[model samples]
Target: MLATCLAQGTSGSPTVRVMSRDTQALLDTGSVVTLLRPVLAGGKAGEPMEVACVHGGTRTYDTCHVVIRTPHGVFTAQAGIVPNLPVPLLIGRDCPIFRPNKVWHVDGYDKLKPFGIAISGCIDGYSRRLMWLSSDSTNNNPAVIARYYLQCVSNCGVVPARLRTDCGTENGDMAAIQCSLREDHTDEFAGPLSHMYGTSTANQRIESWWSIFRKQRTQFWMDLFSDLRDRHYFNGTHEHKCLVWYVLLGIFQKELDEHRELWNNHTIRPVRQSLCPSGKPETMYHLPHRFGGRDCGFQVDPQVLQEFKDLLPPTNSLCGDDNLQYFANLERQSQLAPPINWPAAVDNYLTLKEMAGL
Candidate 1:
C-alpha cells in the first residue's frame, strides 16, 4: 500500500540534489505512480546492465521511489531505514565509530525577525541523532539554552563526555557542558568538557546541520509570521499573545521533528567519500549492541536536571545569570505560595469586622 511521503520527493516539486548519487532527482510528491521495471543500465543490446531497479513497489505508490544499491549503503528515496530487509549494500565496517557517550553538539538556530522566536537542538556527535528540539523567545540567553539542554540530557539517559558550541551565551552553562571560552585570562582544565570550547570551525558538526536546516526550511517563516501579524490576532488581548506563542512553538516544533526524523533515518551521505562511513546514524547508535558492543558507560541522573533548571532565569523573566538568583527566588516563592481564593478571603474579612466591637 502507498504511504504518503511527508518529507521526501513530491510531484511537480523542485529539483533537489540527491546526496547519495550527486544527481538531481524529480521530487515526485506522488502525483504519478510508477512501478520499478528491472532493466539494463543503458540502451545497448547484449550488454550487461551496470545498474538495476530495486524491483519493489506497492499498489498505493502514486510516484516512483528512487532505489539503488551501492557498496557503502543501500538507499531508498523515502526517508527511513529498514534494517531487517535484505539489501545488497552494506558498509563494510561501522562508519565513524563512536565511543557512544562521548560527545554532543548543541546549537540555537534561526531567530525569526518578525516573532523573534528560534529553534535549538542537541545532536549526538557520534550517532548524529537529534536528541532534542525546542522553540524559545529569548533563545540567545543561557536560561533558554539550559532548559533545552536539561530536557535533552533528561531524555538521552546519559551525560556526554563533552559538549561543543560556538561561544554563544545561549548554549547555557552546560551542567556538564563544555565551556567555549575562558575569562580573566586564566586557563581552565583542558579536559573533554573544556576541550569543546574551541573555534567555530571546531563545531562543524552542528554548524553544518544548521546550514542544511536553513536551506531545507525557514524560507516559509516570513510569510507565515506576516500572515499572523496582519490579522491582528496577536494584538487583541494578553490571552491572544500567549495562545499565539504556544501555537507557533507547536508548529515550529512539529516541522523540526519531521526534518530531524528524515535526517536521522536516512543514510548519511558525506560530501566527500572519506568524511564518514556510508550508513544511517541511528544504525550506528543502536546496532552495535548485537555485535559485542560495549554497553554505554555514562548515565544521567534525573535529579541533576532540576539543578540546571534552577540555574535558568524564570521562564517568564528575562534575566541574565547575574540576576538569575533573585528571579529564581521569586519563582520559587510563587510556586510555594498557595493560590488565594479572593472571594472567600473577602467574606472572612467581612465576618471578622462584624465580630469586632465596631
Candidate 2:
C-alpha cells in the first residue's frame, strides 16, 4: 500500500499516513474483539482505549484480545475502546502490601550529650577489640561489631546514618516490634509504611541535624562537666549536676564554627588530584608527628630481611652490574646493609681499662 509522510510539528518529525480508513481500522482493532466499551466507566466513543491485543503469530488469530493463559481468570479487552485515563497519575503502590506494621525510629545517644548522636564507627570500637554493641537479637562479637560498623560507615560514609535495631526477641513474639515499627512509620520516616525497603539513603537528610544535637550536648553536658573537672571543682554529684545542667539548658544553640569549617574546607571542596579514575583522596587527617600520619620514606624491618628479599622484584634482585650498583648506592645512603658481627670486632679492640686488667 502507498503512504504519505505527514510532518506533525507538535509531536516532532515525520509521521506516516496510510491511504484508507479501512486499513487504519484493521490496524486499530482486529477480529473477535470483546466489548469493553460498556465495561469502562465514564468512557465515551472516540476516546483512546488501551487494547491488550495479541497477534496470530503468538496466538490463533492474526490479532485478538482474548488472553489464552489465565491462572485465576480470563483477561480480555475490547478493540477501539479507550482505557482508564485518570487526569493525575496516582503515585503509590497498587497492591495491598504486607509491611509487618513495624515502624522503628532510632535516635542514638552518646551518654554525655544533650543531643542525639549517630556514628558510622563500629558500635563497639573495633581497633581495641572486635566487639560490637548488641541491640539487635543477632549474635555479636568484637570482630562482628567492628566489621558491622565499618561496613555501615564505609557504605554510608563517616557521617552516621539513622540506626536500625531489629528488636526481635528469642521468644518469637513480633508484636512489640511490629507496634514500635508502625508508630514510627510517619511520612518522613519509612518502615512498613510503603513497599520501599529501608535504606541508608533515606537517613541522609537527618545527618544535617546531628551537629545541632551535638552542640546542645557538648555545651550543656560534656563541655561543662569537662571544664568543671579540669578546674578541680568537680564534686561527688558532678555526673548528676551535668545531667541536671543538660536538662536545664532548654535553648540549644548550634555550633556554627566547626560546621562552617567542614562545609567550606571539606564538604564542598573540589578534589583536583586523583590516583585513578575512581580513587578517592584521603578524607581523614591526622597530625604528622603527634599522631600517626603518612610515611614518606620506605622503612623495612631488620628481622624481615629474608622475607623482604623474597618480596623484591626479580630485576631488583638480579646479579647484573646496574642492579648491584643501584642496591649498593641505596645501602650506603640508607645505612641498611646485611647484618654485621660487631661483637667479634669489638672484642679484639679492648678498652684501656680492660686491657690494663687492673
Candidate 3:
C-alpha cells in the first residue's frame, strides 16, 4: 500500500510529489530569498546560486522554481535549493506568498479575566511628537477610536500627510475619515491613499514610544492590579472589574495626560542615526521649518469635520449603566469621597467591592 501510494507520480514529471498532510512550509519575513529541499524539486536541473543562511554563513546551491498551493491560491517563485532543509519549503519576503493575514483568538482563561482599560494614541512621524494619548473603556469600538482622531484634527486644524495604523478592524472609521479629509487635496498622498494600514510591528514610531510609556507609567498600575489579585482584594469578576475601572479610570487618565504634557515639552538629545528633529517635541511639531522639516499637515474644513463627528455614536460608559448607577449609589450611601490617587483608589475599590457583596 505504501509503495503504491509513493509510485503514483509520472515517470518524467518535473514537479515534486509529496503527501499534502506530510508537507511542511515556513513563512519567514526575515529571509530575502525562498528556499526548497532539493528532493522536493523533483530532480530538476539548476544553475549554481549563492545563498545566505540565518547562521551568518553562505553556501552555493542549485536554484529551481517552486510551486506552492494554499487554500487561498497558488504561488510560484524562484528558490535556492537547500539539500538538508528541515521543512519541505521556506517562503521568504521576496516571494508573493509573503502577504500577511492576521487572526485574533481568545482563550478560555482570557474570557474569564477582567477586561482592562484600552488606550488609543497617535504621533507625528516626522517630528516624533506625541499627538494624543488617551484611555477609554474600550478602544476596540470604531466610534471611540474615530473620536480620538477627529478630536486631534479639530484641535490642530489639519490632517497629516498620511495616517498610518495597524490593520485592526477598530481603525475602520478613522481610515475612512482620513481619506475623506484628503480627498480634494492635490498632494501625492491624497484620497484613498492617505491612509496606510500595516502590521503594528511596522509602525515603529509609536511602537518604540510604548516601551517608554510602560516603563514610566503603566508598569506601576500593572503591579498594583497584580497585587490586588494576589491579595483577594480584587478577583477577575465582572462587578469587581467594573468597580476597579470606576474608581481608577479618572486617575489613570489624569496621570496619562500629565505624562503626555511632560513628554511633549522635554528636550530630546540629538542622535546621529535619527532623521527626526531632536529638540522639544512641541517645538518641532509647531515649527518644523526651523529644523529643516516641512509641515505636511493638510487643512481640514470645519463643516466636513463636523459632519464626520456627527456620524460617530456617543461614547459609552466604561462600566455599564446599571453598574455605574449602583456604584454611584454605594459611594453616596457610604459617604466615601472620590479617589484622587492610587492609594485612595485602591481603598475605594475594596470598600465598594465589600458593599456590593462581590
Give the number of the best model, judged by lDDT: 3
lDDT string for model 2 (152-266, tens) is 3333222111223322221112222222323433332233321111222222112223344456434444565465456544442423232222222222112323333343233
Clashes of 2: 12
Q: Candidate 1: what lDDT?
A: 0.44
lDDT of each: 0.44, 0.24, 0.64
Q: Between prediction 1 and prediction 2, which has the larger lDDT?
A: 1
Regarding TM-score, does 2 or 3 come out ahead?
Answer: 3
lDDT of candidate 3 over 225-314, digit per residue (tens): 888888888777777778877888899889989998999899988642123346887887787667754565777888888999999988
Root-mean-square deviation of every model: 15.4, 29.7, 12.9
TM-score for all models, in order of appearance: 0.50, 0.20, 0.69
Worst 10 residues of 3 by lDDT: 1-10
TM-score of 2: 0.20
Off by over 4 Å in 1: 1-97, 111-113, 175-195, 199-202, 226-247, 270-272, 289-297, 317-358
Candidate order by decreasing lDDT: 3, 1, 2
Global lDDT for candidate 3?
0.64
Which of 1 and 3 is the better model by lDDT?
3
User: Order the candidates by TM-score, highest first — what do you get?
Assistant: 3, 1, 2
